[model samples]
Target: MRQFPLEMHHMAPGRVVEWRLRSTAGAQSPGPDGADGTADRRASFNQDKHFTVAEESRAADDPTASWIAVTFEVAGPLDEDALTGSLLAFVRRHEVLRCEFRRLAGELACAPIPAAELALDTVPVADFDRTEELTRFLVERFKRSIDTLSWPLFTMGAVLREDSATVYLAFDHIVCDGMSMPIVVQEVERGYEALRRGELPDPAPAPSYLDFAEEQRSRYLSIDEHDERLGYWKEFMASGDGEFFPRFPLELGVEPGRMYSIVNEASPLLDAAEAEVFEKACLAVDGKPFMGVLAAVAVCLREAGGPGVYRGFMPVSERGRAGWGNSVGWFVNTMPIEFDASPGRDFEQVMASVRAGFGEMIGHLDVPFVRAWELLAPREFAARSWPYPVNFFSYIDMRKCPGAERHEDWRPTSHVWSAQANGACSWFQRDAEGLHMNSIYSDTPAARRTMDGFLEALRETVREIARHGSFRRPIALTPPRRPALTPLDVAAFARRG
Candidate 1:
């Protein structure tokens, strides 16, 4: 193996290089029984891609560092000369795209390694019959590819042009997250278009993902500021016992396997009315609608024959606070929330409890889920009982996808759903033509029916609350209750205050 420094290194502000692979040449060796065979590991980075720039900076907050990998591909009978010229030009224009990673001490980091720049090598095969073989070969090479610094992860493949032939590029996910793919893809398109048109690609002045990662480090690293927050989680997790409400009847560990079923239905209500109802319920509970919705779902779970404990994980995006988002990186944190159930509480009272629980958790949103798990359980109980029970529930917040505006573009798509049960199920909500309450659980018909009935009962409960302040009949099994508070009492209290 050999590496080449970038001849056009100074074209960008960052370091860039081209890495080349040496050929077997006259070094062919004897294989088993003294017969000659090719070395399977022979590969040249120069043949497929190049890097314009790279950095050696380590993530101050995380042990991992970051790097960028860029590759070029050509299609059809193959325009070798055009592809070569285009790739060379691309490496010269963008410095960040050509970086590589290295280990610093015990932690991974990135360096301006001109030695690992992308390059192309000659493959003597031209038969189109090896198309599948070529694709598989490229994907396999990518699987072995690494950014060493950034999560030490790799991309599957980045396909450039697939007219008659296909080319792919891959990178580790540490320096990038799922959200960053669109920007990277768009830049690739721009680079290819510029090369095809015989012009220098315009340099885009966006900050790299590394910058965003550094920002995350600053916000989450303050121990003094975060201690109170951490302590809150410690207390919250310690609040519950080892018992968790399971979606399945058996203990969570007894699962044969999880099951998935699809539930699609149309609500007579228009989108506007549904939104109104949700907001109204929130207002009825003092205007924290997420709490209202979650409480409703909890009620449904209670009716669905749960393990008597309502708990699940919810992901909160920390991108918008002080220094996140805008740049592409993964900064999501999941918190475990438990809902205490009693027949004595009013639906609104339950909603208020959920609202307060989540509000407190968000104050400590910077803690990672792994760390939270550590703080929440006893050393012995941590491994056996779930940090939170398996019956997870989240509202479907898919409004990010354009609504009726792109209805014509949608085709009937089917997806496999799986929620591993520790003797529980995972449920999520999303807004479609109507409400979509998706349940993922063990592959049992009875459990599925139970969930369906639970959903029905939930809707019924919500409707009752919407029309009347309480259930038509008081919970018959509850202890005798004091007189319920009314809207007049609320209004008079507000007037007094």
Candidate 2:
């Protein structure tokens, strides 16, 4: 480990005394007395500590880059000292924050480090005009690779402005998910507030991530109890046509040397009144905002693919269990949502089908996608095909979360790393402001066109819903008819022409 001499510099207003942080020694278990003479804290390293199958697959596919970033904008005079103390407290409360991963006997093992060893970095904001510089800094931060075997799987830093600052907590997806972000932020805020009042932050609720991990391992190892659920998935996979669902047809051929990139398209913000109407419409149909957005996607897919089954993946949280709601870890599992888009069916029918499919999937959510794939499909087939692109929909109402709304002004933003191999993925989040959607696809003209069309279709679907005020009845539609050409037919025609 590298050592550095202690140094002091002029402390900024309301700033904590800076400490020279030295790297901890190798992954050896700490002694009875921590480096600072504090009592040693150790978490067992076991097979249960290994990453989830989804996380393991993601890491194996792309280990060097991070796509998840949680940025918070805070307005008012900042207190660096209080913030540092709060962050340390927050880390100590969540074992996953102090945990790192290492390869042991052909498997990954987690090692927990003392929270005292973690440090926060503060970068001064020279001027408000340095927007480009700040963007570059954040981009570089997200692009930097995480050393899984190290003590920290995440990084925390602040871009300090005179009266306001932006605090960023970026992490590799392997350690956290979207649901975990708000919890982390809320805890940090509470910790900061407690420290500001010269009080120690309260202990986190029972059932930490380690506890959840053990429960997950136990459930996964004993599959006999979940035989019915497993059978349902196996049958579902087998019932599908031999061919995978079709990708959106691209007009132009992909360039030989083209690189992978993400293209994002979002609908205009729905104002308070407009959002109200949309919410009412959703409730009228026994659906939530997520169902509304998903219904729109289903409509678009029906229009794009035509008279066939459409398959996509949705990530559901397992935090509803007792003592698990507030736990910070990747307690999310991906489940398949299949909708049969018959040409004769109307929008209402399509939505009803979607709602029913979603309900059934949730009922059987205990079976992890990894295990389903292993039991239902061949290894070669799983490796060669990207069967389930994700459709992520979340509603984050900060008003309900304590401490989150205390700031004069704050906004949350997220980004995911994109790769060509991953294919197309869509995410939707509805907050107080409005609805925001981000879609990632390959950086090709054809890909862009397909995405643009899909967004247009989604907007049209939402407008129709609002116009009708309820999804109880089918919207206007023309007589059912087949497309002039399938994607394959179009490709053949393109080659011949």
Clashes of each: 25, 1
- Please give, for residues 201-234, the per-residue lDDT of candidate 1 as tens digits: 5444334434444454445434442366567565
- The lDDT of each candidate is 0.39, 0.54
Instruction: Tell me how far the alpha carbon of residue 194 in candidate 1 is from the true structure, in angstroms, after superposition.
Output: 12
Q: Which candidate achieves the best lDDT against the true structure?
A: 2
lDDT of 2 by residue, 262-303 (tens): 553333435445666777877777777667767666656666
lDDT for model 1: 0.39
Q: Candidate 2 at residue 86, lDDT?
A: 73
My TM-score estimates for the predictions, one after another, are 0.49, 0.76
TM-score of 1: 0.49
lDDT of 2: 0.54
